[model samples]
Target: MYEIFEQLLSERGVTPYRVAKETGITTATLTSWKQGKYTPKPEKLQKIADYFHVSLDYLMGKNSSLTTCPDCGFTYDPSYPEDIETHIEQHTAWEKAVKEFGEIYSDGVKCEQIKAENRKISHDLSLPLEERCEAQIRVLRCLFSRSLVANSYSLDHVPFDTYVAMMLNNPSYRKNNLEDDLLQALIDKYGTASGMNSGTIYHIPNKSKAISTKDKRDIKRDLDRIMEQLSNQEYGPAAYDGEELSPEAAELFRDELEIALKRLKLINKEKYNPHKNKK
Candidate 1:
């Protein structure tokens, strides 16, 4: 019984000293309870149980579940929901997909194919309970990534990866559509990973994968090309147009374009060139 109380305390992030201080139970008494040296008095047990939102039966190990469910096969949580068969089914589906798709690609691939793979492996494959939980998380993460890419234009101020992870972890997050409740939970957890407005997230397309560091390099290359094109446009046409801009027009253009030029200069100055600075 006291062992149960100790487990609950750890789960709730409560220190024995804190519990002792709050309940006016002595440190030695709490220590004894933890070591199974003494069972707590009824009133003390009640106080501890109430504080932890656990039943006395749970605290005393009379019942194994922290919250009992008749249908759940397990006596303990495995980091996924119990009493919900869908959770287990989801794990099974993910394991099937993994066996079919290989490691990284399993999550990003099409669900129908994944489901098919799951069918193929249905007779031969069996994951341990912990591995099943991890597989579910992977599938969920992939699904979330795809959803974010689909709606990236509408989303505001959310990092692409965090948003995807949040949606996957949330049980009530709907498939094929972003939910406000899920978004709110994301905001709460990540506290605005982007600078954009909150409501704008709805317009963004969901992405299938996170923006890799290599992708950032590609984006930078594209931007550099655009900058070159713009610079050539601003300066090259004088040689091509068969006439140079008048001094006054050129001066006006330079002044008007000063902000953009400065921006380009900043980008050039800060750009990280891996080839040039090899370790």
Candidate 2:
């Protein structure tokens, strides 16, 4: 437990002295923990977990997930659930088949040769452990090669495994939108908010009303003297861009723009079927 704590602290770039200062624990006690001189109580362990924003299970090396679910704040367990075990086993078998496919796609290997090999392997659905392992190697290699192609096209790091997973999960969508140049541009123009935050839709006014008529009328009497003084003077704009935007207005506007763009693009893409005319 002490070793795990030390490792986690080091990984997060935390110093023992800094942790002691933050947690109100003495440096000597923290040092003792690192040296295996003392075991922390439950309360102390809880404090450590809170300070690092990590679960006690992670601190104790019992789980590997780095984040907790925002909705329930439940700590993520890296271990697969019992129900998903069968799915995982099936995926493992698929991986074995992919290995041989990868070998053929290697730089020196001919594409025709690899295609032939893949066809032969595909015919044999009842694969033994040895054949399955070979297939997986090829699949992994092919996936890596495909990701490399994406990386070369765009000067960005694309994880091979992530690409492969996406392809398997949504074959048609992945094929259609494999190398999306618009994604980064969209994220830059509008921000990328994930999960529930991304789902939120907000409304914006057609035109920004600096001050509503009622509010403006109420303030007119107060500013009557100043209004006369400034009546003749030409002011380019308000003190700070026509009155500072409210926090809610800014956040809602931000959310609205992103939601609108994403929604519109998806709708347009779905409605426009190029194959319809041909059919």
- Which model scores highest in TM-score? 2
In the range 129-229, model 2's lDDT, one tens digit per residue, is 34543443354345445333222212232333343343333434324332243233323333432211111111111122123222323343344444333
- Candidate 1 C-alpha lDDT tens digits along 66-163: 32223211123322222223334434444443343333222333544554444333222364433433344444444433443343211232343555
Q: Which parts of model 1 are misplaced by more than 4 Å?
A: 64-279
TM-score result, candidate 1: 0.24
Q: For candidate 2, what is the lDDT?
A: 0.44
Weakest lDDT window of 10 consecutive positions for candidate 2 = 195-204
Tell me the lDDT of model 1 at 7: 79
Which candidate's lDDT is highest? 1
